[model samples]
Target: MAVFGTNETKVMLPRNIADGMIKETRTLSTIAKLSAREPQRFGETEYITFNDFPKAEFVEEGAQKASTTGGFGSVKSKPHKAQVTMRFNEEVQWASEDYQLSILSQLGDAGQVALARALDLGAYHRINPLTGSVITGWDNYVTATTKSVEIATADADADLRAAVGLLLNQPTSWGVNGVAIDPKFAWSLSNLQTKNADGSPSGVQRYPNLGFGTDITSILGINAAQGNTVSGTPEAADTKVRAIVGDFQNGIRWGIQRELPVELIRFGDPDGQGDLKRNNQIALRLEVVYGWYVFADRFSKIVDAV
Candidate 1:
């Protein structure tokens, strides 16, 4: 008799074409949106860098009498060696194909989101770092001369205004033209009220248009934006950077490489037993070179408001 029967039942395997898809998650790139991008050139293994020179001092003319040897200011570019990476698994791509979705597009989107978030955080650290801590971009050139203002527990509105006032006091005529506030703090600020002569609520609103849905786009005639990355510990006595106000154009610097480098290898696996080969997946990587600099410390202010 033959080993195999003439009639046999075969097992039926389900195809991946019927799987449902879930909604995408939210990723905010707040600081990146506010920053300016300048391109720089560097080798793949080398760090990116840039320089910022402070303006030379001005002296009163002495009736055409030559001024003593006024020295020139020299500032060197700060090196940015920090890099962030992103990876996508092959299994996820297969599942995406089964679900009738473009895995490559999804991966690209996720990669951009990750890079944006990482860059935003990098900018924040350079701009509003904790007390006694050395800042990245500014520490290299200037001594990271960050200024701050204290806030009252019950009323932060006055403190906020005062903070803005302090920023405007800088010698630069531009003054403080921008501010980045914590989302939670901004929410509380939206409800701030003016006080009566007796320090009681005057039934009048201050910053009536400060909230999320208001028409008032700025606070104190300066551009204002809400960023969750603005760091601050609610219960700790340590210095928390809740808000940052400044002439961002002259205070903050963002540098981009020649291009946003993205690479994908559909058949990176040569053998059929390696991780990629066995998993039947492709490979993807993102590489970017950039640098950041804080030009004038006095041009910026960080608020430690709780």
Candidate 2:
């Protein structure tokens, strides 16, 4: 007997498509490129954080060694699902093999981009890209850290330097090795100019290497990535977060689950639009789980004056 209902069931995406999506996500997401990552499963994954490191002490001969302890803590990375669904013409199903592959590739591209954006939005701003709302219960870097630098309209260089200074001056001495900056903030840096002896703008660019583009790889000798997600759209008109500077190797960690499911639905309205069957459209839904944790006092955010 032919099982027609089974044909509409969801299935795991091909390994090639899934791997390509992950590669594109890492390429597009600034945080993903800078932060430490690990393989995450469906459940919680825990990583240890050191509050203090025990030091070796010089002991006198015949003297008893005193007991020493180091402060250690753990942070659990809880799985958060991010999904993207798109509708396409049903005619794609009857297309040639090459044409079908092209359509699938395009769908994969959209899914990767959405996943990248969601990572930035959730990790940096705690915003959910799907609902355009703040995700409760999880504190993003902006809300979780107290260290911050306010940008002055007159001195963009000072703003960046101040942000780095905050990290270096911390009691634990955080390093400023990587920076994820917003597009608007990058523009500010590129337009910065030195002043002449008479207080006039010296035509020379203060940071000549810092340009306003998506391909920015470095800023002032520090690794950098530019994306609008750095300063995500908040629900309210609050202080705009411009950049995050920190020890990317140790300050934050994130990961995505390997299994990615892509489903094809030819009936019903999955997106609240008209029915797909009635409209002669089919929907492709891609889902993947992601997790992240930001260490306390390890990062400093730069924001415009409130």
Candidate 3:
């Protein structure tokens, strides 16, 4: 029966709930686990990246030492706002205290999942999750890098190895440190089979230790994480990008604001989905700021041939 439309009316999510959401997001988002994180403020944050390493030279004693030029550039991170809003029955407001807490917890979980997916989609695919459209002027990993390895059905292991090779072979020697893969691609890795002398199925899995659980911590000795958002469903007949391997520590960086605002809407159609008061429904919205930048061509994508 009350309308609240001001920032003062907004509720800061409980610290525990916010912490839980951040933990779940990091666990679920491969990009978050693989990339470096830098502190970011409300405005743009700039990072310096060297294009060329300084050369070391041997100089005779007292001889003039020449200065070697090392090219460098700056990359700015532009914060992108993300939000998750859910509508619930207004009756829950009067429900038992435990029930209300349960509802809030569930909402937090949903927000984390959404944020995880958004991080992958935006950083890997340059997609804006809210609109399901490519973000203009933003180049994601798959789009920004020319290095790629075609997935080989006969040797999935070789494909990944080659992908890693691409990163290591960069001009600046970008060593592969982390791999982010789609669940489907992760399955393919897990299903790699050993062959007999005659090339028959040896009935032994090549990587018997590999597990296809919700969390895939490692692949081929490199840290890894799994999420469907790694390889979004491509349009029909398009080359599907399956995985990304790179020097995430030095090649890419991301940051999330510490503050997460949660607002309860009691009236009006915030989502253009009819008035909440008339529908006897209340909406909970959680919003956060996220930013990222790919500073080098140190990533290689594994893609299926069209």
Candidate 4:
């Protein structure tokens, strides 16, 4: 059973962190041997870099050709089978949470499903049988909010909460407040670190950073100017109830390079940049985050391990 009882969960997204979340957390020892104990752990091992290009030299006329033919900027990272490390974080107690955690669970499950069906090479070895901490893909989402013409930043929080409540109240199979992660996803995940473009890590897992919008205002909520009542509506009251779709503004996608168990997955990008890590066999972490922009252009893609 998981260290958090059978039903315990890692705090995916901390509730109090409005500015940001931790990049690392306490490491569990059953699956990994920690070196420095990163607050956010990693599952990835060695990664390839353009820096691996063969050493070059100025050939004197015609000496034995230097190690490589240098290309001014043609170096690229190639796929390789790197070591896979799995990890988990939890309290000895039980189910506590972060909204980010919920998001991670959703994306990680989706990644697991997509990877399982497509990983025909069979790279995962399941080092820890008790809990398959090995994972393949994941998500992260942040709301880039802007004040509406009539709405102030002060009101953003309440509006966001109201929108979330509305979504929660929508009809579904389970009770409105207790929506479960989609069951069709494959694979599994623990948490991972996020980082700045300079690579200073942050406490965000990489998975389920989804975008769900069919029109404008996906990231910003209702915006209206003061007005008079025409249809029983008050001034400054915009009838457009479309809540911002946080995922639609920025999102990502990932695919494995070679065969290996994915160990860690981080998600946030500090310095407010637009890129993320993906395991095309780069980076030290096994399951580095990556990017893509496919807004349901076709059928949804995922891996479900049930």
Q: Model 4: per-residue lDDT, tens digit, 1-306?
A: 222234322222222321121111111110011112112112232222242335657778767874574333321222223232233232212335343245344444434433322221111111112133322332111111221212223323344444344433434211111111111110111122356798764656432222211111111232211111101112222223222211221111222333222233333332233223332211112232211222111111111112
Q: What ordering of candidates by lDDT runs from best to worst? A: 2, 3, 1, 4
lDDT of each: 0.49, 0.78, 0.78, 0.25
Question: 226-272 in candidate 3: lDDT tens per residue?
Answer: 77777654311222777888887877778895488788888899898
What TM-score goes with each of the models? 0.62, 0.89, 0.89, 0.16
Worst 10 residues of 2 by lDDT: 1-10
In model 1, the Cα lDDT at residue 133 comes to 43
- Per-candidate RMSD vs. true structure? 11.5, 3.0, 3.2, 24.7
Candidate 2's displacement at residue 246, Å, is 1.3
Q: Give stretches of model 2 more than 4 Å off.
A: 1-8, 60-63, 140-143, 212-214, 233-239
Worst 10 residues of 4 by lDDT: 25-34
Rank list by TM-score = 2, 3, 1, 4
The collision pairs in model 1 are 38-256, 50-77
lDDT of 2 by residue, 39-140 (tens): 777678888877787677789999999877677788887777888888999887777767766777888888999998888888777887867777787864
Residue pairs in clash, model 2: none
Clashes of each: 2, 0, 0, 44
